[model samples]
Target: MIQPTKDEIRGWLSEARNELRSERFRRRLLEHELCSAKRALGNAVLKGQINVPIEKLGELVLKLQKESETEEADM
Candidate 1:
């Protein structure tokens, strides 16, 4: 039988923990990712790679957050 290395075992455990995550915890993570994503998008727009107005960005975030909350309610 093949044995997994210590690093591989640790990675598996980390993935398993994520799979068992609570909705509240997931929502918190979503919020963190949302912030980072917005920052990245802003940088991309500044670099001229994407074109998005400030008002549009705000609206998009609001729509995404509302959808996320609805999904969490079902979870």
Candidate 2:
């Protein structure tokens, strides 16, 4: 397995900061480019990512812009 060096991760973060600020990520709710960090978070918190079990978290998704760009079959 290839794990990123600390400096590589830091470099990615710096680039991510620019992309997130300049690109559609902050505005678009459903889609963004995926990285290991994102994949890991999604896997760890998959349940709470959508149709969340907890009330407040569900409320948070509802309160924010929530839409499905792809069908369940795709994921």
Candidate 3:
């Protein structure tokens, strides 16, 4: 599996959110993306890559939590 940079992940998530027509669908997609991003981030962390800043991890977690909250609100 190829490790993706935080920027790449952010771009992909942004594109997904933009392309989605409904908020409910976007939230669902975001949750899926969070899982994929976590796996990619795990690989990067294991490789000890100094290029990808550690700050991105927290940002990713926060983004996922926010998405979750949004999803819950829709229910």
Candidate 4:
């Protein structure tokens, strides 16, 4: 196996960090979008535009909020 030089290792680490930062940024954007979509759905339900049960929608929103929190914590 060929051994990597210190500079090579540093470069790899830098790349990894950049990639991770990019991924986190993307996730945050997506999370915001998810929240927006949830709000829109909730509004639609409230306005009688959707036929979903209120309790079911609340539960689904709660579940999604918890999942989003968990993901944020993980990051």
Candidate 5:
């Protein structure tokens, strides 16, 4: 079996690190999009614009609002 040289190993490690960084950035972007969608859904429910069960929608809206408030407080 041929062993990798030091430079080859370093290049592989650098590539791995770059891939991890890209994955993390993509995950963060997706998370932001999901949060936005959830908030929009919650708002629609609260406004009677969506056709979901009222009780469940109310609970979801309240939960989303609470989370938003908490995030604001943290910021």
Candidate 6:
């Protein structure tokens, strides 16, 4: 799977929140993607493939956390 940019992820999160009208739903989606990415990174690391940058990982994690907060507030 292709890695997504932080801006692309943020846009997707925003769109999901707006379209679903449920922050919880958006959070779930974000969580699933994050888990998938982590697994992919793990596999890549084991195989000596180029993994994602640390900075991008941090950004994605922060964004997921912020989105989770939004979900909590809406609930």
Q: What is the C-alpha lDDT of each candidate?
A: 0.87, 0.62, 0.80, 0.90, 0.87, 0.83
TM-scores, each model vs. reference: 0.40, 0.29, 0.37, 0.75, 0.71, 0.40
Measured by lDDT, the strongest candidate is: 4
Candidate 1 residue 54 C-alpha distance from true site, Å: 7.1
lDDT of 2: 0.62
For model 3, how does the per-residue alpha-carbon lDDT over 6-73 read when each residue is reduced to its tens digit? 99999999988877657768777987997798888778787886355669877867888898799789
- lDDT score, candidate 1, position 61: 75
Residue ranges of candidate 2 with Cα displaced over 4 Å: 24-75
Best by TM-score: 4
Clashing pairs in 1: none
Model 4 Cα shift for residue 14 (angstroms): 0.8
Candidate 6 per-residue lDDT, tens place, 1-75, comes to 999999999999999878877776887898899889878876886576967678886887798789879978987
Evaluated against the true structure, the overall lDDT of model 6 is 0.83
Model 6: ten consecutive residues of lowest lDDT: 45-54
How many clashing pairs per prediction, in order?
0, 0, 0, 0, 0, 0
TM accuracy, model 6: 0.40
Tens digits of lDDT, candidate 5, 5-75: 99999999999999999998997899799989988886886688888986876787798789879978987
Clashing pairs in 6: none
Winner of 2 and 6 under lDDT? 6
How do the residues 1-75 of candidate 1 rate in per-residue lDDT, one tens digit apiece?
999999999999998887778766987898899889979987998898998888997898799889979978988
- After superposing all C-alphas onto the true structure, candidate 6 shows an RMSD in angstroms of 16.6
Q: In candidate 6, how many Å is residue 3 off?
A: 52
Which regions of candidate 6 deviate over 4 angstroms? 1-21, 51-75
**Per-residue error (Å), model 3, residue 38:** 3.1
